[model samples]
Target: MTSLLSVTDLSRSPDLEEVSFTVERGEVVCVVGPPGNGGATLMECLAGTGEPDAGHIELLGVTVGPGDRRPPGLGAALRGEALPARMKVAEAMRLLSRLYGTRGLPGRLVDLLDLEPLLPKRFGRLTDGQRRRVMIGLALVGNPELVLLDDPTAGLGEGSRRRIEQAVDEVRAAYGGVCVVLDDLAQAERLADRVVLLRAGRVLAEGTPTRLIKLLGSTYVMGVPPHLRVDGLRDVRVLRGAAATYLYGSRPALEAAIQDLSPMSGDRVWSIRTPTLRDAYLTLSAVPEPAALEA
Candidate 1:
């Protein structure tokens, strides 16, 4: 089946390097990466706010190239964009709806984003989370066929982040369309139908959240002291962090490594749990070292 949105070999100087991906109908694709990894740049290119030095973007069968007008059905909520400080949320929504020629403020979107109570509040008076929700609503003004959100939940608290996640889900369900969200790995794990892991303006890995996690080839992760050594352990990958040294391997391998450890007075401490997408991201994005275990 043809994808709803396709980005091919999209490149920009010093930031994006031949980045590419596709979004299917009704699917939510999250581009996960650290800051300055080109995730935001990718969104800007797709939104037609930034031009790509090479390659092209296609949406709904329409090609968008450098200096081309934005496609008709594309909507974007980019970072650092703000509504007028004195404009009330309701006024802002109505104004964008008119600008986009949309019917009006969508009741479903208002409910999904919990914007009813915020209608009367000025943009400056609304909290960051509330303002973000309003921005998302503005982006959806015309029921766009493709939506691009850059770091939609950035700098939000855990509760606000969860609320945004829920809103994304509800909005997708209520209005069927393709969505592309650029955010951190944790948010990608929660919201992505397919995860695109980007690093240094390039794609490191792309797959479903489960598939990406499977790339780690480990069922469990054990966090031991950074100074502890497991010299005899095989088939385990070790990542040395400032706070803890994480060992990724199967359950039995970790158990064997634990048994081999010489009893240290009460000082020996370790923790084991299931591996997550963040663990996979860290492992894949890490620079190779002489002591690092290969998959």
Candidate 2:
């Protein structure tokens, strides 16, 4: 019942206005916001990576210092930067051995990250997925109470992304700690128990993903089901209040839908977007539809 991280009246002016949230132990809170809207800054503040101009952060029942953006040392290193490319994977990990003051059980790390067969490989030799796993292993090695991941699957392939997501779930289950994932709705939905939508640095809404969908009046999605074809229409009336967007390839169809349906100039008419994580991402972060934008 104890709160792990509490932000009371937190404000990072010129950016984050006033922000506040409590991340209890064992909760995965996903924060989604527009680009350049301070989502990362908020995550850094919560993760002790950056300070808030005005706010108190209490972590694990203790008050932590203001945000520190000092040059990244261990985290960056584990992020797979700064290491000598030729260095053996084991050697790269061992470099931190002295700093951590523990001969980290490399074998265990390998096991936990499923890198046993990859231990002897050099940093330059591993595939993209293997490298990602290494960075993740290093980041979570300390076993902190609250873990923050910023765009954890930004560049990886679909298969690699799937692995990273599974790892996130494993970490949370293993630690029973709060994890705040900072990513677009695509990545966050995989791990979030609840999502907080931010706008101009302030929380616009907070609830479970399903609740957010309902709030946005999103369409029912069943994961890549067969496509629906609305034959030859100048316009088709959109289901009242559903948030779909017009997208590529269906231009002719969308035009037809619009032609057949009577649309008020002021009515907000959104076309269906391509089916992808980004579509869900857009829908996931949509602002409350204004009466004017709807047209």
Candidate 3:
């Protein structure tokens, strides 16, 4: 199937290098990476807000450029300040609809996003999380064929995050196109049909979440007391935190290593049954796990 959005060898300055990917219609693609790793820069380049020093981008089969023309039938909300400070929330929403020539704005969106209470408030007066809801709602105003959300839930409380996530889900259900950019790994795992993992200004890995999680295999984690001396432990990778040393590996090997501990009843212990997308990310990024650090 032809891609709805295709990026070829995209790069910019010291931030991005030869990044490339494709997004199919009705798919939600999440970009994940650490700070300054190009996730946000990728979004800006896609939204036409920033220019790429090299490479090309195609949205709906047309090349994107520095020209004033915006991609037709595409919607986006990028980082930085949002909305005119003095504009009321309701006015901002309506003005966006007018700009897109969208009529009969769905009342369900108002309720779905719980926008009623904030309607009369000015954009500058709303909290960061509230402004995020507005930004998401604004992106959906024209019911565009594609939407790009950059850190939509960044800084939100639990309730607000769920509301924004629900709005994203509704967009896919209603329009069947979305590319959600997120810094949070767990959120990416939950919402992504495909994931693009970036590190040090490059695309380190890209694939389905399930496939990526399997990169670490069927792993198990054993949490032992922080002070426990695990340097002598064999056939296990360990991640040490302030409270515990997390040892993980294939099931049988990990279990055998745990038995070697010969633990008493009071020893702190826990287990992670499935390897998560975050685990795969850390492995790919070459993070300094305890075992690697000791080596």
Candidate 4:
């Protein structure tokens, strides 16, 4: 399997400390981490919009770092991309089509993004979701071999979100392009073939979503009363909420703890389930602030 993009020991000053990953062709790799932890920087580095302070970045057989121009055959749509306010959707698409040597929508991007009705709409007048759908179409205009998306569906309504998700699946399957996405755990689970967990700009864990989730072993979540002091459970991952004390651990261990506690009240209401990518993510990332941990 040939790697479409590779980053070796990538580092940037404040946000990105040291990061590395490989994106293979036809793979949707999701990059997840604590907010403000440099996931955006990583995308920029790959897209050549920004350069890393140190380390190597290679895409499509081309090397890019500080001062190097972005290579062709790659497309990216980062957050807050500002399109010309007055430009109509058709006009913008036409211009991009010319630039990419495509006379119209590249492949099925027009239909995939449901952009037909939006063609006459002004960019400024479009809602955030509409703008994102346009941006997604724009990214595909060049028929790129790799697409770098920074939360493509973030802040959108459910309808637009589902559309983008469907478009992504279709694009990857039809075009065999690689995608590197920066998004939340749920989206990562839905879209990623491989997941990278980052904290403080460093790679904490990287593997298939299932593989990472399995690292924690058969996890069972038990709910206890908030007033119950659970500081004694040294071997479990606990998330305390206002109404319930959520305990995450192996089924047998949680059962043992429950037996030891001998639930007196509502603590009897508990549920056990397998750990998800979100669970593994929370466990690996940990809570950012001390307040989140203090019960």
Candidate 5:
């Protein structure tokens, strides 16, 4: 089946490079990576707000080139997009609904996003989280075939983030359209059907959450002091961070390594846990660039 959205060989100098991905209907594809990884630029290109230097985007079966207007069935809730400060939330939603030709108010979206209380308030009076919820609601006004949400939950409190996640789930259940969410690794793990990991303006990895976590090739992660050494241990991959040195390996290897350090003071601390998407991301990001490895 044809994808709802296809981005092929998309590039923008200094921000993106040959990035390609597809989003099938009823799927949520979260794009995530470290800071300066070009996610913002990619979202702009997908939303048709910024022209890519090369390649193309196909949205809902229409091929869109650089400088072209965004396709009719595409909706975006991009970060920093502004609404008129004087406009009430309900008024904004109704206006967008009319503009998109959707019948009546987006009542389902308002309830799904828990916006009833804020509906009477002006855009400028809402807090960051409330404003984000409103933006998402506005984006879904027309039930567009493809939805682009850039960092929708950025800087939100836990409660607000959960509400957004729930709202996203409700939107998917109601519309079944493809969603492309630009977020961090944690949110990607919770919200994405598949994740695309980017770094230095290039695709690093892409897969379901479990599949991406498995890329670390370890069942457990043991964290110890950065100065501690586990170099001689078999099957252990060491990732030294500023705060802790993570040792990624199987259960037996970690157990043996811990035993070897049993004589250390009780105050010496260590921790062991299963590998997560964040761990896989860190491991992949730590890899030497292809050119450096080849050299």
Candidate 6:
């Protein structure tokens, strides 16, 4: 199969360092790295929004050498005021569609994003979730062969999140493109075909989420809902929505929760490890930064 995007000996300046990766046609390549490690910069470079100090960026098999190249429709990504706050949802999308000569940008996007009824609402009147969906639709409207998404599901409720996840899948399936999404590991696992672990702007380990978790050993062969048994833990403190409570037990909260809800509660056994993307991420970027947590 032909590779849609490839970066050989791809290195960025003093900050990004040496980087290399590839995305074949119809594949999702997620670049996962700890915060403050230049993941955002990579997106900017790949999307032609920012210049990389040095590196070769290939898009659709065409070489984009040094300095960001404004690939056909990439210019719109850097437009100021991502969405027109004063414009009605329908009106704004229509304008963008016309500008790009791509009709149905708004009406079809509304359905894809579950925003059919929201199209009538002015941008300012929409809720945060509504706004997010609209913005995402516009971002994808350019028919980009490569999409860079930062926290795609941020600020949305669980139901909305599932929808966003499904939308992402559809985008890849229909567009035959590569979408680089940045988010917690859980989100990555849900959307990515492969994971690239990075640290301080360098690739550390790259593989499927499950393989990385195992390579990480007991460090993160763990995690679950707020309340679950954690392997090799005497106790755990779960901090959710600002209130911190300690779950003290001989096992992880997941194991305990399982036993508590078991059909044979009287003879029940243990817990569960949901294996989220966040779990894998922390393991790849773990540095015992307790002091930073307080900061």
Which residue pairs clash in candidate 1?
none
Q: Number of the top candidate by lDDT? A: 5
In order, the Cα lDDT scores of the candidates are 0.78, 0.56, 0.79, 0.77, 0.81, 0.60
Model 6, residue 217: distance off in Å is: 6.1
Ranking by lDDT: 5, 3, 1, 4, 6, 2
Clash-forming residue pairs, model 5: none
Q: Return the TM-score for each candidate structure.
A: 0.90, 0.66, 0.88, 0.87, 0.92, 0.70
Q: Which of the predicted structures, 1 or 5, would earn the higher lDDT when compared with the native?
A: 5
What does the lDDT read for residue 256 in candidate 5?
79
Q: For candidate 1, which ten residues in a row score worst on lDDT?
A: 286-295
> Model 5 scores what on Cα lDDT?
0.81
Q: lDDT per residue, candidate 5, 127-159, as tens digits? A: 999999888888888777778888888899987
TM-score of 1: 0.90
lDDT of 6 at 153: 64
Across 1-295, the per-residue lDDT of candidate 4 in tens digits comes to: 6577888889998878667788777778888875787888888777777877899888887887677877778878888896889999989888988998877675466776889999999999999999999998888787778888888887888889888888778657865555555657878887888888877788878889888877666557677789887877756777776777778887888877776667555446456667788777666656452111100
Of candidates 6 and 4, the better by lDDT: 4
Clashes of 1: 0
The worst-scoring run of ten residues by lDDT in candidate 2 lies at 71-80
Write the residue-wise lDDT of candidate 3 on 43-114 in tens digits. Answer: 888998888899988887778886545677888888774888999988987887888888724788777778
Better of 1 and 4 by lDDT: 1
Query: What are the per-model numbers of colliding residue pairs?
Result: 0, 22, 0, 0, 0, 14
Query: What RMSD, rounded to one decimal, does every model reach?
Result: 3.6, 8.3, 4.5, 4.9, 3.2, 7.7
lDDT of 2 at 237: 23
lDDT of candidate 6 over 85-193, digit per residue (tens):
6789878777777776786454554666887887788888887777777777776666666655665665579877777677667767865555564646666776777
Candidate 1 at residue 51, lDDT? 88
